[model samples]
Target: MLNKTRGRPRGNPDTKARIAEAARELFLERGYKGTTVRAVAAEAGVDSALISYHFGSKQRLFGQSLNLLCVESTALDQALQGDQAGLADRLLTSVTSLWDATAPTENRMALQDDDTMRAFRDYLESELLVRVAEFLGGPDATERATAAVGVIGGLIFTRSLNPIRSIAALPSAEVRRIFGPALRAALHARARQH
Candidate 1:
């Protein structure tokens, strides 16, 4: 006769997946600041310790849930390299294509709440805009980078989510052609010392 040990059951590979799925759903529903590890654990039917064990932290869990493991940084880095003249075109191509290919669910998460939007903006600034500004390297670099990112972001939001008729009707190549010059101008804005 063996005595029964009472404790939480051992976690299987499936538990991680379940936790991730739960995290994604909660993140989409409640946004980043609103969602907690305890909530995710509840949603996943697991203990909070399991979340810590599996993902280490809420931020890590969020990253896994969103599948955004340095995607923006990598994309921006690639777009920023080689041929400064074509920077706008390359950025438009890379960034638009990326968002266009992204799942609707993930995109919806960005639109969920103020917290989510702030988180998204913060992530974008840290990952892409700030990097672009650093790459440009000038007194006007930050503003120029912001303008460039705004143009790209507006295009993505309009084309992908909101769908403005004029912008939506244009083919990808035409969109790139029409917007490239403005973006290039913004990026090439002259540096000034005040």
Candidate 2:
């Protein structure tokens, strides 16, 4: 016989957001290795288990805390699902759509915030780049992921922050048409081994 608890676990409706906010503050202050799940829960005034329930692990909580850096996994999956040659186009379209949804002012502000930018890099390395490299599954997958992200990061920065008139004035489709081939080349590059 097992002792069973009845009903779903009860928590504040805002528990997830609260936990994430607390986590972001701590992570920015202490860096990834220094921040603890217990500290985040205490900051948020939630139980430690609630953080696990909502985010699964500290790494995931870190990713969520950097919400501004997120790209929907479904979107990335959809982009990667198609023909090999179209991968760059699909990915650019997916990412650009998300960027287009946010106001340029918001993008600029987020990019300018040193703490937020650091969080973005952390999320890119720990989450996005790792997932992309694993999905590619080759000896050079990490290299390809790095190149792809570099290209995309440059595109985002030029469009949102520095605002190169030539790049920024063009529509997303046109921008994709011009840059997609370069991105595709980066994505498909195989390292020349000695």
Q: Which stretches of candidate 2 lie over 4 Å from their true place?
A: 1-13, 30-43, 47-70
Give the whole-model CA lDDT for all candidates, comma-separated: 0.72, 0.75
Clashes of each: 0, 0
Q: Give residue 44's lDDT in candidate 1 (0 to 100).
A: 86
Where model 1 places Cα greater than 4 Å from the true spot, the runs are 1-11, 14-64, 67-73, 99-110, 192-194
Candidate 2 residue-wise lDDT, 84-156, digit = tens = 6687888899778866776666666656768867766665666667767776777998999889888887887
For candidate 1, report its TM-score: 0.62
65-184, model 1: which lDDT tens digit per residue?
Answer: 766432354456678898767889889887666655666446654555554455555555654687788878867889999988888777766765566889877867888899998899
Q: For each candidate, C-alpha RMSD in Å?
A: 6.8, 4.2
Residue range with the least summed lDDT across 10 consecutive positions in model 2: 2-11
